[model samples]
Target: MRLALAALVLLLAGPTPSQFAPAQAPAQLRRGLASAEAAIRAAACDAERRFGEGDPDANASRCEGVRGPPGVEVGRTSARLRNPRNAPPGWAKAYLAQTDGKKASEVEPAVFDLGDRVGLLRPIEIRKRCLSCHADRAEVAESTRAWLEAAYPRDQSFGYALGDLRGFWWAEAAK
Candidate 1:
């Protein structure tokens, strides 16, 4: 009878916050983020090879082949956004500001403690290959520029140089 009463109380109260929290260890979270990042890079590289570098369509293919690992949320965001949907959270904006004028190789991944969760951020650098799509309007292929305009009409993601800090890839998991 006591067990039955406890069950009823739990049912009425619904799941506790801890129940919704990610239970992965910090090491597991790191591993998951690394795996997700590798998958995304591989997918993007394959797409670039198949569709020709700098094709907006190729860029879009990256997400099609990748999924965020279970128990964590992963995404990319930039201060100069092509997609407003990729805007960084409040905490991330502060990190982004710190990356200004720094090369990806020069910056280290940032880790954060959020009371109930942990967050990790890695810098995304603009490489030579990236310029085909992310360079100045005059430098990018006209066709690619046109596609970006049509797809992300308010795009502000251009004008980046090789070795520049492009943005960040971040992951969050409950502690």
Candidate 2:
């Protein structure tokens, strides 16, 4: 009777997370990275369209205030998701670590997965308008230019070469 009850309970429990795990982190990472990329791309397009339409509010303050470059909202989202603490134990750091005097844009999207556990790296390129907002110290506009200068004084984040690693969005999930 006890054995039958145990079997019944086991059957009712269904499959656990360990039972049918996902395949590769790349797919999930790609999806998440895609989402973030889409968001940033969309924002860039909207900003450009608005600016072209002579929308004064377009140059308002979406990328202003303290923190940092809020212009690439989707890019920021991607970065946040890849952070070690906020992300899974299997985290990664994605950035172009200055090759020559070129800065991050030279290397394209480089990612370092901290753990070999569960996750994949997905990179996204920053577009032209994205660069206008994210370009190095001097390339920024006069309005928020001061803020950027104050914030990233040693900003080596501009004048990117083509096919560079604009940045990446890491997707971490159960393995």
Candidate 3:
């Protein structure tokens, strides 16, 4: 009778978390990382399209202050000089190394941690279309070239072959 009553109570209590199961941590982390990745990718695509349309400037400033879900902080940068704020801090350099030289990066999702938070690293590669402004000798618009020269005097992100790891998006979520 006690077992039956206990079973009934448990059934009425709805689904209880298992002792060995984490309480929504994994789900929250997955959702956060996914949202962050989408946010960064969309922002990058918009910036790329604008740049292709003759606006020759980094879009990092535009994406600034764009926050991900509650505890997720997202941002993007390159290993090159295009994004003046591309300096890799902490374990970001290591993650970039892991992603470099690989044509198709197999992202190990939510593998990094920042204090009590988790992180996602997404590799960025060069496409043939990106050569317009990034090729060392491509026939870029004179105005755009001059603007780039004036903006980034020591730019070194250009002259890359397609499939090159241009950079990566680094995002973190509270664990």
Candidate 3 lDDT by residue in tens digits, 94-115? 5555655555334433345344
| 162: Cα error in model 3, Å | 2.2
- Scanning candidate 3 in windows of ten residues, the lowest lDDT window is 16-25
CA RMSD per model (angstroms): 12.5, 15.3, 15.6
User: How many residue pairs clash (N, CA or C atoms closer than 3 angstroms) in each of the candidate models, in the order given?
Assistant: 0, 3, 0
lDDT for every model? Answer: 0.68, 0.41, 0.59
* Higher-scoring candidate on lDDT, 2 or 3: 3
Per-model TM-score, in order, reads: 0.64, 0.37, 0.59
TM-score winner between 1 and 3, please give it.
1
Relative to the true structure, candidate 1 reaches a TM of 0.64
Q: What's the ranking of the predictions by lDDT, best on top?
A: 1, 3, 2
lDDT of 1 by residue, 78-157 (tens): 87899999888655666676676677788776766555566666678887888988999999999999999999999988
Model 1 stretches with alpha carbons more than 4 Å out: 1-68
lDDT for each residue of candidate 2 in 1-175, tens digit (9 for 90 to 100) = 9999978866765432211112322443444334334454455555455544356566446533323122222332233222323332213321222232333343333222223223333344555555554665366687766765576565445555445455544333222
